[model samples]
Target: MTRAIALHQVSKAYGRAPRAVDNLSLSIAPGEFVVLLGPSGCGKSTVLRMIAGLEEVTEGELLLDGEPANHMPPSERGMAMVFQNFALYPSMTNRANIGFPLKLENPRQDHSERVESTARMLGIESVLDRYPAQLSGGERQRVAMGRAISRRPSAFLMDEPLSNLDAKLRNHLRAEIAQLTAELGVTTVYVTHDQAEAMSLGHRVAVMRGGVLQQVSAPREVYALPENVFVAAFIGTPRINLLRAVVHAPLDGRMSIDLGRQRLPLPEPLSAEHQLLRIQQGRDLIVGLRSEAVRIAPPSHARPGEVALSGVVEHVEYQGHEALVHLNTGSQPAVVPELESARPQQAARRRRRAGGGGTGVGVLERLRERATGHVGGPVVSLDEPVSGRQDPHSPDRPGLMAGDLVVRTGPDMRLRRGGQVPLLVDLEHLYVFDQQGRRICPLPRDVPGLDV
Candidate 1:
């Protein structure tokens, strides 16, 4: 039978600040699969541990089948856990490892029958006599899982169990694990730092950052309609592009982002959920543009509100399907368009509050000083945000800027580091953010069937 898991206001801490798993409230239905995903150290594992009773919860409650399980010990929780490291006994043969849990729980069962059934189910019958030392990594992992499943725990909590294997092995095992879970119809909560794994393995993915749950939805929903900037930045590959922008009128219409020298219009309209932190033409606002939103448009055919910039290619990382261009803007170091753009506006606002005025560079330096807690460092001396952009146009465009801009191009585009290329920013894909780093507008609808 399937069993669900719940965590209400669950939190954990190390000292002054929380280490991982903050105020995280989530419910996984019976037989549902959920993957907790984020960058390493973002607390994905902590949440799984808390659910499994492996880690102590600083505050809040954990529930199994609607019963509070926080104070209960791991063994009493009726849950099984799998770890990234394959914890197997070297002395035990495969048969013994798979049957260990069953033997411990019900010592009266005939060992050969239980062991034979599980070994056949896992297709590891031939390996039953082999010790862990004789088995490969994948074989050892299967043994660990087989042991966990022997007693039929109500739910399974996996903490990157496939992480220790090579990529090919991981792929093969992921399929096997999915098939096994489906056959068992067990509720599962998995944690991983890899987006690909989370996307493929889970029915839903819960994204966490710095111990806080950001968004919990189906894998595609989390990717297409991220609730905030952190989710948008953390979930996608070619990481969503964030540029500095300003909000414009036609309040009910699409969000109009003003790049420093150009203006781009969003294809998706903004919702109230978009928290507008700052809105000024010359002031700073973070604008998000996914790599796929950028295009290599001919200068003559460029549409109005489209942003055009010229930069020499600095470096290109080739993925089989696409190539990520790393441009050197010679102004800001490869600042993620979303995270850093808001700093300038916040700085400007602070300066305006303090009655000071200078250039963007000065304001940026002061903000850096305030951030780093150092008083007299050369803030403007920071490396250019991107490399290769030697000459950017200086037109009086709305959203155009001269700092950092990343252009996502097709793999076959074939441009060298020193070659000058003209890039176009699809303003329709822009993401705006407030001062607190929350998204100021709804993200572009990358997939259909989503409301916003």
Candidate 2:
């Protein structure tokens, strides 16, 4: 029988170290596949461990099948876990390893038939008699999965199960795991830092940062309507182009976003999303555009909902199917510090330095401010050099700076470096985030009463 899992303001901590899993609340329906995605140290694995009864919930509740299960023993949770390291017994044969759990659960009965069936299901039957040290990485992982499958648990908790395999094998096994889980129809919660894996395998993806849940929704919705700057910057390939912009809305003039050297004029009869920008007049904001949101074309070729902007080609990354063109538009890029990982102590030191004699704020409060874009100073140009530091975006060519915006185009479009190109921005796809990093444009249908 499949199981439902729910966490209500659940948190985990070890003494005074900042909460590893903050007040996170999530629900996973029976037979649904939900992926907990985040960078290392974001507490995704901690959440999975708590659900598996391997870690204690420091605060709040963990419910299994609508029943309170905070104090349940690991074995009594009715869940099986597949770990990252392919936890297997090196001394025992694969067959014995797969059968060990079943043997413990029922010592008098022979479990050979069930073990063989599980091995065959995972296509690891041929390697059953070999020791784990004698098998390949993929084969060993299959053995680990075989062990989990033999138990027929109601829920499957996987913590980067395929992370140890090669890229090709990981892709192959990813598909296999998806198929296997669907057939079993068991509730599954997977944890991984890879966005590609999360987008592909999960029925819904839950993004986490600094031990707090960022956003959770279907893959497409998460990609198309990211709730904040971090989500917008995290889920896409080549990364979204995030530029520092100032909204200029005059009583009788066109509303536009000023991007240092260029301005994006909002077309007349402003869209509801753009209308919301009226409240942001003269305010600094972050503008996001996915590479696909802009195309390399002249102003005359602009389609409906398109605006014009020009850029100088700074770099080109040619992939097989398409090319990513980086352009220097003299626009500033917003930096979301420590987007890949969280280092608390280093962050604390940086905070102390920025606070100019330790502004009495605590770490968690500072993290919340950083997440909301409140603590960081105004947008700074990464292309410029600081007084004592070397320029991070030093020009490859003398006097020519690197690009701040990346646009995807057909691979056939060959363009030379330093060439000026006209681009069309689809206003409908434009994203705007306030100084607090909250999405302001493309406002929700039922707008919240909170002030921006």
Which candidate has the highest TM-score of all? 2
Q: Relative to the unseen true structure, what is the C-alpha lDDT of residue 112 in candidate 1, on a scale of 0 to 100?
A: 79
Candidate with top lDDT is 2
Model 1 quality (TM-score): 0.77
Give candidate 1 misplaced runs (Cα > 4 Å).
Answer: 15-19, 247-256, 261-283, 299-310, 328-406, 443-447, 450-452
Question: Whole-model lDDT for model 2 versus the true structure?
Answer: 0.86
- The sequence of per-residue lDDT tens digits that candidate 1 reaches over residues 1-452 is 66878889988887865346668899999999999987777788888888788888899988888998888898888888887887887788888888888788888877778677777788888999989998899988888888888778889989899999999999999998888898899999888888888988898998876667778888878876677667777778867765555556465555555654555544443434333422443445566677677676666767754666556566777888788887643232224322345676676568675664686766776776455422111112223333333344423423323435466678898786555677776544556665445665664444676533
- Please estimate how well model 1 matches the true structure, expressed as its whole-model Cα lDDT: 0.70
TM-score of each: 0.77, 0.89
lDDT of each: 0.70, 0.86
Worst 10 residues of 1 by lDDT: 373-382
